[model samples]
Target: MIEEIRIDNLGVITRAHVELGPGLTVLTGETGAGKTMVLTALSLLLGGKADPATVRRGAASAAVEGRVLLPGDAPAVARAAEAGAELDDDGSLLLVRTVGAGSDGVAGRSRAYVGGRSVPQAVLADLAEALVTVHGQADQARLRSPAHQREALDAFVGEAHRDTLARYRAAWAERARVVEELDDLVARTQERAREAELLRLGLAEVERVDPQPGEDVALAEEADRLSHAEDLRAAASGAHEALAGEADASGDALAATEVVDRAKRLLEQAGGHDQALAALATRVAEAGYLLADVAAELSSYMEDLQADPLRLEAVQQRRAALAQLTRSYGSDVAQVLAWAEDAGRRLLDLDGGDQRLDDLRARVHELDEAVAALAADLTQGRTEAASRLAAAVSAELSGLAMAGAELQVTVEPAEPGPYGADRVEMLLVPHAGAPARPLGKGASGGELSRVMLAIEVTLATAPDSGAARPGTFVFDEVDAGVGGRAAIEVGRRLADVARSAQVLVVTHLAQVAAFADRHLVVTKSTADGVDVVTESDVRLVTDEARVRELARMLSGQDDSEAARTHAAELLELSTVGR
Candidate 1:
């Protein structure tokens, strides 16, 4: 519950502080006395839109602050903490909003704070959604919206419908996901088939050639050797003839092996006289052995060397085939092999497109059934709740001086949506035998106000069953066109609602004002000059002062003896059943 509200430089309020407590707290004053400004200040603190035009004349800014005491486990308390707002020692939260006007034609700036910590205005708004619900003429206008009507019906249904709604929403979300996947697969059927075909062709080509790693380089080297086979054989034969005697050469062409053998024999003959000569002879013998080994290798090489054009052509053709694969798939045989491996895996996936599509379609069908079932449950719950809620509100209306009037809550099947497969609407049956019509179209402004009040009272008085209710309920001009016993009933119902929560009403009716546990009067004071700014002051009025205020509201004359007596009697009647 909001403990207090402070307003400064707001409208004609200038500066005002109002203390609010449990039960019905009524604000009364003459027209244009800034009574509505109190609600506007509360709206600002609740993160409502800020209008610079509301700033008091000659003031640069307007500010509103509220102190709210909440239970430790209240939803708003946790929400405020989540936004980094601190709770006071007494577990009260402070909410502040400031709207500042810029110089002359500049736009205004608005800021919001919670528990002395600056936060986004939206954070304050979210917290306020769970803390207070303000009803005024504008809210009555909202009753015409189908969405709002559905929301009201759902809220009236309480936990059972909420549970079914949650389940329906979950099923609907999954169904949407499955449908999306199915659609995507269906749309890509032709594309996936084409991709698979391309992959198949590429993989078939790679399999036919069957290129090996490093095969391209090895083939190139072999081709070069084969192309120069005759030249290489001729060079090896010449070297062999120089190292060992040629078969058709003259004897004077001494071979390297014979020369080194002769040197070794001469050195051995001299070795008997010196050890150094013996070592020189061993070196010459090693040289003769190396020469002989070279001669043998050259002879074998000439025999093995050959020039086969057919084989060379085969190598060239094979190389051209590998090059083609490389051009289309990769830079070389190794890269082409890598591409083939990857494409093979991708081909598997693309080829299974039909199977995946079948699976998704089957899943979508199952989810659709689940969602339909849940939607049916939700619709049934809402239909039942709507009937009960309508009866309850209708009963409330009968007590508010509309005994013959009835509220009809209609729940009809609608196309499946995120919410459910039901459309809820509120209709008003003004009197006996009157045809039921939509609220705004069938009810007068005064009737609409009463209807809204009735609905609020019914909902507030209903058993909570553990659901959180907004701590504060504000009604601005809720008694707009109500009078006599009807106005008194409105006040009495507001007080009834207040028994469970805090309620504040801005009213002009003396009957309603007289029922308040606390009465505040907003009075305007004019300066000496007619053009001077008018100031509005809000103060608690009690005892004779409160009686005089009620008298002015009753007859426009606070000093009238008859009006005073009537005011006193009305006050006395308001407390008759307390």
Candidate 2:
């Protein structure tokens, strides 16, 4: 429950500190006395949108701060803790919101704080789900919407039902994804066929060529050797001849072998007389042996140097074929081989398109059946809760002096959606023997407010509502079009709701205000003696002040003695049940 709220520079309210308690508190004042501004302050604290124009003139910003007490085990307490918020020494959570301008001082900007620590505005909204429930003229208008009606029903069914709805949503999302994929596959069938045909043609060409990795490079080397065979053979024969002279070389220069033999024999003859000469003779023999080995290898090279032109011609043709494959598929034979491997796998998958389509069609049928079952389950849950909620709200209507006014919550079949395949509608049966009609066309503004209030009351009073109770309820002019006895009943119902939570109401009806456990008055003050208004202030009123305020609300003039008498009597009566 909110213990107190302070508004600074919000709307006409310069600074107003409202002390709230765990019961019904009422705010009443003349029209434009800023009663609605107090509600606006609460809205800001709950993360509602901010308006820079609502900020007081010449002020840099508008601020609203609230003190809320939470049980140690409350979900909101845990949520704040997750957000790294700490409770105050008094064990109360502090929530603050500020509205200012952007850098341009034209666009509105806002900030939120929880438990004295700055947090995102979304955190405040999350906390509000557990902290406050507000109803106003706008909410009353919302009551006519089918979506709102369905939400109210779902809220009444509690957590177990929520889990069911969640299951339905999860299934619905999966089905939507599957359907999208299936649709795309079916839509592009012709395109996939065209792609498969192209891949087949490319694969067949590669298979026919059968190019091997590195085969292109080996063929090129062989062709080069074959084309220059004559030049290569001539170079080898001349080198061999220089090392080993021909046997018939009578006119040619002396062969190297004969020259080496002559040198060795001369060295050997002189070696016997000198040790240095013997060492030289040994080195000359080793050189002769190495030269002989080279001459043998050169002789074999000349014997095997024949280049087969026919083989070279075949290599050239094979290389040209491999080159054609490379130009179409890859940079080289190795890359062409890799492309074949990948295309083989892709072709297999493309050829199996019929099988894939069959599988997708089967899965679609399965999901349709599964979703239909889930939708039916959802409808069952809603139908069950709808009847209970209708009865409870109709009972509240009876207490608000709207006897014979019945609320019928109908769950009709709707197309499957994220919520479910049920269309929930709230109908109003004004009296006995009257045909039930939709609330929008049937219920007057006053009737709608009362019905919305009853729905709220029913939701709040549900067993173990937990976070759904919201700890606080604020009604802004719920009694707008109600008067006389019905106004008193509206006040009484609000007070009854306050038994389990704090309730604050902004109303102008004197009878409704009479039922407040606390009464506050918003009064506008002028800066000077002229009629130009400057600021509005909120003050708690009691005894004579409260009576006079009620009297003024009753007759538009507090000085009327007759109105005072009536105000006193109503107050005395309203205080009895407390």
Query: Residue 460 of candidate 2: its Cα lDDT?
Result: 83
Please list the residue runs of candidate 2 whose C-alpha ends up more than 4 Å from where it truly belongs after superposition: 89-91, 103-108, 116-118, 214-312, 462-467, 528-536
Candidate 1 local lDDT, 439-532, one digit each (tens)? 9587888898899998888777887422347988999998888999899888888888888889999999998988899998887776553221
Compared with the true structure, what per-residue lDDT tens digits does model 2 show for residues 410-487?
Answer: 999998899989999999987778999999788998888789888888888867442267788999999988888878
Choose the strongest candidate by TM-score.
2
Cα miss at 74, model 2 (Å)? 2.7
Clashing pairs in 1: none
Overlapping backbone residue pairs in candidate 2 total 0
Give all TM-scores, in the order shown: 0.77, 0.81
At residue 95, what lDDT does model 1 achieve? 95
The whole-model C-alpha lDDT of candidate 2 against the native structure comes to: 0.86
Measured by lDDT, the strongest candidate is: 1
